[model samples]
Target: MDSGATSESCFAKARKSDKTRRSWTEREEECLIQALKEATTQGWKSGNGFRPGYLAFLENHLKVSFPDSNLRGNPHINSKVHVWKKLYGSIVTILSKSGVGWNDTEKTIEASNEIWESLIKVDNTARSMRHKRWMYYHDWCEIFGNDRAVGDKAEHFAAAVQVVLTMTPELPNNVGMSLDELFSVDEGGAESTSVSLTPSS
Candidate 1:
């Protein structure tokens, strides 16, 4: 069998495995947002210094939000360094997009180093994962789901946007900015037809 077909088969299996693992619930979203906020407030500079309190907070959240999720003893969430690194990615993405910068010199330096290290890790991870069949399977499953098609690029694009839309509400509100402003609301509080998924020729 061709590599592409083999990869697609694996991807389909992964998608059918569980929708819950692929996407987070609204409660989980709120918890994640709150956790990040609390962690930042507690001076969580990097993965190395991830506090025990934060881990406990997240552990409680997982227990409450996903009682059946077998998150207990899960290295992904239990390991201090691993959880911190993942949450660091979320912080970097949000703060960078919001054009927020650190005021203190120590914090600024730490944030800059974190961003640089994260970028290198991202590049290295992407390169290493591309060669692995499992990575291809997971990536394809995430983008196209079980109903993968030959030319469903538009659907994939729309799905990606929908994922972003879900995260928008979780983003922290800044002093002069808000995610709600991104959408143009009409008289009845409905999004206008101007925002479209179809590619214009």
Candidate 2:
């Protein structure tokens, strides 16, 4: 047999394959939005954190796909929440090193900018996972009826935000002074789009 194959053979093999290619639907997005909004409100920033659950819910259920990685990153393990987990981890690092008071409001922007700068330092294209996580957060908010996620991108991670906000002389009226708290809403009936993030952030 020749080493090369014809287009007909390839087509025949594809047709014979048992599995079907997965694509997204609107209903899946609806369920995902509901689950995420609830999770974000009730347990949005859990002890482990938010992004893990968010991404898992999609890949496991809603079927939000991921882009193929040319750089050898774990494509099968990608999700909105997972991206946030990594970004939040980075944010936490910057916060831990800052040693800024939790109640020192003056350092809020400074700490925030540092975190953002660190992110830019890592990737200037603004297409980094951290930046994408922020886009996910912002888009989620827009769908959930919020003008924005609130606070700087640095505030996206609670562990980091808490360190700086707590140091502030006065916390926000919400009382938590963390990204989790600041972005939280009632989530009573917040049903919107899903995390069908199938490539191209």
Candidate 3:
């Protein structure tokens, strides 16, 4: 007998997924930053911001079992994502550009290379290409390289980017450097600044 229809369970998508964040300990933070430095030394500067390959490289390169932290598992690929951004700055970057995601790190890097190829092909800045299925080098690294896809694969990069943005000292603002270093605690639950040349008498 042909079943009329096999109904799908509503709770299918709601499986108990493992929490995907490792606490941003100092050592991991150091490894992450060092990875960035290595990339830079290899001509992978964040001058125009981040790149997908760079992002993948960072995540993958940080594959070492960093001594100790209250962290759990995701099979530990070539890397983990988002720890450095937490310790340092935000990833989104309003002023800078952005990257896109593919199925895996390979796809992501391949996508970036393809876009770069096209940009160089036309001999334009490819300025118009930002976030339209692809992105410019600067934009790709800053945006797509920073953001994750619509589902669970997104990990910690986005959060880290946010941290970077928060830390970034922009115009018409004084709250740079973690928003903590710039202010006092006794504001009574208000967001104000405390910049004075000297302590008043």
Candidate 4:
């Protein structure tokens, strides 16, 4: 079966399975974030640039982090998948308000191309092709502030570039510095500015 079918099957099974359900704790959430960071840092990619084995890894961490709880045979991966959807959905909403709609792949590509020009202007010293691409992505998040959920994923990077590309043209000259420090809260809220922008730098 295809991925969509597989996901539906798995979730259906989860819904009927007699698994112990527990509330997510603050420490468990931290462990999830750490696992994600490690996966990204280690260049772990599954289908379509998404992390492979992340759910399994997170299950291991949860077992360790919540050792006091009797989590044996719990459907940890399935529960984590549910949590991931909620977290990822919140991020999608925040990006949408920043003018970076994730549904339009063509628009994302167009924005990425446009943002590349701006990245080059900021970092003309980059020589290697790979290095240039890296710099472009790294600066993309900073230009519009950070999205911790997306982290270092390329597709998310491209969408972020699109958001800034769409916003930059409308910025007033005096607010450049403020724009540099602008960011959206991850709670599905609108973007907010943190600093002032000046022409000098």
Give the TM-score of each candidate.
0.26, 0.26, 0.27, 0.34
True-vs-predicted CA distance for residue 156, candidate 2, Å: 14
- Flag regions of model 1 displaced more than 4 Å: 1-30, 42-48, 79-201
The numbered model that scores best in TM-score is 4
Q: Which candidate wins on lDDT?
A: 4
Query: lDDT tens digits, residues 86-178, model 1?
Result: 434333333343233433433321235455456447445423222122212222222222222222222333345556668697755454644
The alpha-carbon lDDT assigned to residue 198 of candidate 2 equals: 20
Candidate 3's error at 61, in angstroms? 2.4
Which 10 consecutive residues of model 4 have the lowest summed lDDT?
126-135
Give one digit per residue, the lDDT tens place, for model 3 in 142-198.
322433322223223434344556777473444456434443255465322222222
Ranking by TM-score: 4, 3, 1, 2
CA deviation > 4 Å runs, candidate 4: 1-20, 47-52, 70-74, 98-201
Deviation (Å) of 87 in candidate 1 = 8.8
Winner of 2 and 4 under lDDT = 4
What is the overall TM-score of model 4 with all chains considered together?
0.34
Clashes of 1: 0
Compared with the true structure, what per-residue lDDT tens digits does model 4 show for residues 49-158? 33556556656666677777544323664565455544443333334332223333222322254444553464442112211112122222322223233322323333
Give the alpha-carbon lDDT of every model.
0.44, 0.41, 0.41, 0.45
Report the Cα lDDT for candidate 1.
0.44
lDDT by residue for model 2 (1-201), tens: 443567778877898662333333445435555556655666444532344555555444433332331211124224433444444444334334443222233223133556566655755632243322232333343233221222222232345445656779485655546465565544465431122112345
